[model samples]
Target: MVDEVKETTVHELIASPFVGAYLVLRPGSPRGLKIPRDKYLQLGRKAADDVCPAWLVEATRRCWNLDISGRGVNDAVVVRTESPYGYGRASYGLNLGCNYDREHCYSTSA
Candidate 1:
């Protein structure tokens, strides 16, 4: 018997960063932005298992320095990219690093 390892996908890499991470998806905007992990991951998972647009996969590859073939993701990542459309409607700007849990926020929108 041989031991096999699981190759992390671009989706998985991006998803690991956690919510409220300051990420910059370039080619669209140079500024880093805090993403709403709840909503972003929802769409990301859909794209990974259900239907992923080409743009998203490509951007993921570039962002993580992985091949476009989708073989797997790399341990090291690339910050800049020629295309950032794969991120969909992700907002751009540096995140303040606050973990905002919708269920645990303990406050309604004021």
Candidate 2:
């Protein structure tokens, strides 16, 4: 049987509350990112303290390279999980700081 795939944006992917790490499928590569939360943040910003994995280097292209060549890196993202299944494990909530503007810092389900 064929595996079910769902379409979602990278922003949504990072925000997904997956219970355990899930596989990320992309052209030319398919890997899972299961680093610690701190290291995951570093990977998000492309800042690695030590040598970065050769596959990890493509995180940027895979996340935001939404070029219109019908081949944008992000255009190919797909996950098997149709719904978030964890207790907000991947949730990155707003800063909700008093100093930050409330309007900009607040998150909406929209």
lDDT: which candidate is best?
1
The count of residue-pair clashes in candidate 1 stands at 4
Identify the candidate with maximal TM-score. 1
How close to the true structure is residue 40 of candidate 1, measured as C-alpha lDDT? 47
**lDDT per residue (tens digit) for residues 17-110 in model 1:** 3233524343333333344545344433453224433544665666655344533223222322223333322322224345554442446756
Error of 2 at 88 (Å): 3.4
lDDT of 1 at 52: 36
Error at 51, model 1, angstroms: 4.2
Estimate the Cα RMSD of every predicted model relative to the unseen true structure. Answer: 11.5, 15.7
lDDT of 2 by residue, 6-110 (tens): 975542223121445433323333333453444444434442234443444455346545222323223233223225335432222322225443443465647
Error of 2 at 41 (Å): 14
Query: Candidate 2: what lDDT?
Result: 0.37
Error of 1 at 33 (Å): 9.5
Distance from true position, residue 40, model 2, in Å?
Answer: 7.9
Question: In order, how many clashes per candidate?
Answer: 4, 0
